[model samples]
Target: VESILDKENFTLEELLDEEEIIQECKALNKLVLLDAHYVLNSLMFSLRDRAQVEQLLRYIVEEPSEDDDSKRTFKFPFIACEIFTCEIDVILKTLIEDEEFMNLLFSFLEPNRSHSALLAGYFSKTHQEVLRQLVDLIGITSIMEVLVRLVGADDHVYPNFLDVMQWLADSNLLEMIVDKLNPSCPPEVHGNAAETLCAITRNAPSALATKLSSPSFVARIFGHALEDSHSKYGLVHSLSVCISLLDPKRSAIASPLMHYFRNQHMYEPPIPVNPETINAMLPKLGDLLMLLNVSSDEKILPTTYGELRPPLGKHRLKIVEFIAVLLRTGNEAAEKELVGSGTIQRVLDLFFEYPYNNALHHHVESIILSCLESKNDAILDHLLHKCDLIGRFLQTEKQPILSGDNNLPTLPAAGKHAPRAGNIGHITRISNKLVQLGSSNSCIQAYLQ
Candidate 1:
């Protein structure tokens, strides 16, 4: 076999003429159904006719309408996997156009907990037309399977998978991934999946609110993400994603997200809770306070069978409160390190900056105000300081002020519907702070008063 295929001395045209090439592919395709390893090993041997080789390979795995007995006859999935994997680029590019081929590829690839790299590699190398074909043919169900596979693997393909997931017009795949964080996965997967989900929402938020009402999957994903395991990466991400997904327009999700905020918990080592998640959710601080009430031992809470603690670890919740504490009152270092580490910005971008058109702004403001009322000077101090900083930037900074003309909020003519006074008042007061400290170096004083 090696001697036959190694005869690359022949030109591409010559190889096409060789009857042996066709015979070999037929033989290999027939036997491939019997023993995948044989073909997988032979894959390294350069086939004389690469095109025909690829076509014959696609035949065994991709042919549609195979009877159960025929499926049994072929010992597929594994064989399909071997082919898809052997010349990953070739298989993906060739089969992607054929709906049946694409379905077979996804079915075989979907179950593996670590196909992310392979899928990503295909996306990276394959032509755009082929990629579009793959995604279009992959379908929502298989796409979800791909998400699950990628998340489970937690492979290097995360970014590539992210690129494709972002282009999806449907939210089922996103919901499926986010939902798993709550319970289907352990703490790490919850957090990692959350970060990926948050990124998706960030890139396409308009698409996000469209599906926020149905967040059963999100609840589960974030529920588990709230844990503070040894690795806080995922937990922090889960926290961020949860906040991003909240939309007062989707009152159902808003309430649940608020519940999530109220139910903050921590994970021990192996799954550390990220302090940043707390800071980003700070604008919704009321939810944190509510969670404290929910977790309190004073009232008897409902328990599941053999329930030990509320699913979220007790210490983990304490950690969450600690983060809330930082959001409310941490020093510049805490903000610089945690909140400033892009987490808070992300939250603000989703809830405060964008999507307010649908009532999300009120929920965000309500959360922040509730946190300000915590009576914990630390929590109150940090928030007040941040708001002051934001106001000063908007009021005095020539860039923000000039830019406002193009991006300013347009109010209704007179009183068709007055905007919320609370938000207006908060801005007014913050602006006042900025005004009082016009030229002097008194940011702290402005924040303090």
Candidate 2:
């Protein structure tokens, strides 16, 4: 096996075990991580003899064709990429800390480059602390702009770009992409921006929650979706970032986001829960509800799922989930505006209107459970006086089985996707919670009675 930082003529591939995957004599990083002794000492070992840093860069930059093959070029890119993932602290720090080396590393990403995905893994491996240093070396705006340009410059580069974005996201520097989310920006930029944010949200929601926690940031995210509902991709991903941030259980390390008014439970929201953001989102929800509540002859759904139609079905699902969070989280300005909007009825309407989709039911149930658990007088009043809470539940009760559709609320009914074991069911459980809460509150008690 090759030694770290060894100047004694050695091949980088030797650093990895002889018979593991990806290429027999090559290193697979997952296996490298398991080398406890190597990981513990790899950093110190690299520092003792730093020359290997330059050696790895040569493999990455040259990225030679497979045939000509010098000893290092044979599997050079693979070897360098995998090694960087090992003792990440040592190799990544060495690459990014030195401005000259950093520039060489980035050269692998120059426009029209081939084999970018592997090269991107190299970029993604750089430590975020290096972000500040690199930013100082070359302005962040320029760097991201160039990177985004490189992304769209070639279709081949797109997937590879995501690999680099993972590093940028961890580094907390998505400013350019976030700004590009504005509808005012070229529509072309909007797709990439939305997707980049979507990827981050999907891959690392909690991190994104912390990274984009500003009131203004949250507001802009939803604002763009409304301004440019024209793009299905934009609206879907824009809403995705919002909905992920609202995850009640996410509880991102609240920043100044905590200074705002609290939710019903007084818990910190995943995003800032900006009053402005909530305000922007409601009209869309209001309009969507109006569409659902109406007796329209126009074809609304493609199939039994009852989603709005291409690029739109997914968007509607995200919108419902987003509203569910807002309802559960309880922003005062949001609640006051949303009260008596028939949100519960509208979502429940979606529940029965759609073909069996457990995802839709979970969100619909969230809205119902949120209202049933409400401590706010206005919400209780809305539920009892304004909306037909009891009648809706009755209409919803045992609907699938009684109608003999044989539809089960549960998906796959038997696997890990299955719900927990319980003798009681959805309506029964909600009814019980309603009864428990009504036991304590006069308004709720009156409604229950």
Candidate 3:
């Protein structure tokens, strides 16, 4: 984007290295280093020539030939956009207050233009962090105001910093954000995109649900989640976005993947997922879960001689967590699938397989608890009679510390069940969940005891 300014003109990098940016920005004396002074003086001098930033903005909006798309046209504006990111008070203050600057910036985002993609780049990993740091430096509300002042110009758009919400509601912005949540993108891109999408959802619980709940979107995201070779963060971020779509009001707060439903103070009704989407993804996700159940092993950490990673199905933790979210949201289709496909039974096996992965414990606990609380007789019947819920727990409780013992229905000669730390609480929660069922059958009472 900045080829024009690389050598022919000058680069801020040539003057001030990254580590010295803050110090240079604060050097009120301005006469610090010769290189810095020279570069700043030259850049300031050009600010008078055709109004540098304004002209660059215009250049950015121009369409380039197909072959020329890779270079040249984008040079100056991207350079200027990046420069604006530096803590340069004079340029930043002027740009923020200038109506023309804001308009020019927004103009870069006009429909059917390359500028949209260019501007979207700012939300990538690095820029996302910069925005966050800016918020920390100047609170959220002020940052929101500052964003409008710095980026938008139309009276309608700049009046409120929720300008994004307007765009999200009016046009294809939300779709673009959703598109970025795929495995093809970098993990950080997916993470930042998911965060942005979640914020938009919180602002409108059901307004955009139909768009997000589309089968294609669900399949793409879930497909990425099951991808064995993609970066873990990318998959987890996609799952996070998926959960937000399913349960818009579950927990508006963006927490860790495993902690998505925790830290809640108020009850929020779960949004209904599109039945078509649920049906489409259930079999695919269940198949993947089952594959991981068999393909993955529970070998302890390896030494320098072997693979240093956890067993193959490590991401089962994320998949299981995702399923836990679905169950917790009372997704009827999901419950039926878990029971009918024997997925819930496998998930319980997965829980014991990775005893050392305490996070998996919580996910497993959430899943079982959600099921017991669901009160769906078929699912409950499968768990109690066919799945042998009580027998499984009792077997796990009594299984000798046998090595190579992975899950229920199998116990090797010597092993340690990692769930021993919380077995008592686990049993209590099962009993509590059963009590919530409000059944007074003698067998249920005995099982509780």
Candidate 4:
């Protein structure tokens, strides 16, 4: 043991020699074959030269494989991880200023690359002060790609990545991400850009809110994306960001969609939401809702299918929740737009389709409750008559009320109100208010009665 220790105890000068250290690193089959700490110390000492640092970073970013002509496969990334684990500040200070080194690190973010995890981990440990400097050199898109890869590549939780995400938000990277979500961009690029925005809004919501204080930029970008049929891949993630940002309790920022819905009449030419876009998105949202309301029986399949499916429950719930937020905002124009767009009917269809989903029931009920509470005669008339929403509710209860009966029939308590009794009571109270408001003429009262 003493002899082995003695052999490993090389002086810093000997280890720092570029050719000698590279040869030693190349000789190792695995990073564990050498003393990682010693290799890291040597690399740090050799990082004074910009060319050497870039060279070392390039080596670290590439993975070891037999097919490569360059036989250098020492797992320098593993050594870099060791350095990051111990002296990230020192190494970042040395490399962060080097545009070439930063670009080399950014280059590893290509989706096909295997070493992204290591680079992500390295950047994850880097101090914000040092990381902020690399923002310009690395560019926002590259930084977002790095973050998207970091979150996607590893199953393990990385709390440090949250700090990096916050820094990005504070540095105003949202607009860049939104800009990248263009129809012309590749699906993967759009997906990454959208995913990055979702992650930032989720992990650093307050920072994102502060950065997106006006909401116009994000709104316009998402609106355009939402209107484009080719952007389906990006739309899901963009919707997620919208959901997070518009959450009144969780998000401090107001959504531009919400604003648009509230004041759409103010625009000369209304936003053109193509029927094609609506048709494409509505079903996706509906399918997500149905998937969320999956029965317990759905979880146990008889066959060992090609692969077990992931529960679409959460995403489904998220879509409904987003709609619920819009309704709860009490924006009359928004509510009217939703009704006109058939979103209200779709939500009702989902509500009736999934009878046993408590979460779905709650969100759908909230939308109803918001509409009733708005007390806008036009809106209420639309809900009660035009959409025949009350008839749908009666159908859901399976109890048809007579047109002129003074007494309402006893609704079945079991399926009718088991998961949503409060919703029933809310409807009853609102129906009475509508009757008093005179919007409930004989035609409307017939459904409520």
TM-score of each: 0.31, 0.47, 0.58, 0.42
What is candidate 1's lDDT per residue for 1-449, written digit by digit as tens? 43444564643334333435444444544453434555434533434234544443443433334455543334332233334433343344445444444344333233343444434344233223333333333324444344433332233443344433433324244544544454434555544454445444434333342343234444454455554343445554555555454322222233434544553342111112234433344444333333433234332223221112223333333334334334433234444443344333333332322222223343344334333444344434555564443654354333221121213222222323322222343444434544544345243355544
TM-score of 3: 0.58
Best by TM-score: 3
In terms of TM-score, which candidate is stronger, 2 or 4?
Answer: 2
| Model 3 lDDT-worst window of ten | 410-419
- What is the lDDT, from 0 to 100, of the residue 277 in candidate 1? 36
Score residue 307 of candidate 1 by CA lDDT: 19
Poorly placed runs, candidate 3 (over 4 Å): 1-166, 169-172, 206-210, 227-231, 249-280, 294-299, 302-314, 399-422, 435-449
lDDT of 4 by residue, 283-357 (tens): 334333333333342332121211112222444555676677656655555666676666776666555544444
- Rank by lDDT, descending? 3, 2, 4, 1
Instruction: List ranges where model 4 is wrong by over 4 Å.
Output: 1-41, 44-90, 93-172, 176-210, 220-234, 251-317, 399-449
- lDDT of each candidate versus the true structure: 0.39, 0.52, 0.54, 0.48
On lDDT, who's better, 1 or 2? 2
**After best superposition, candidate 2 residue 63: deviation in angstroms?**
28
lDDT of residue 49 for candidate 3: 43
Kindly give the number of clashing pairs for every candidate.
37, 2, 5, 3
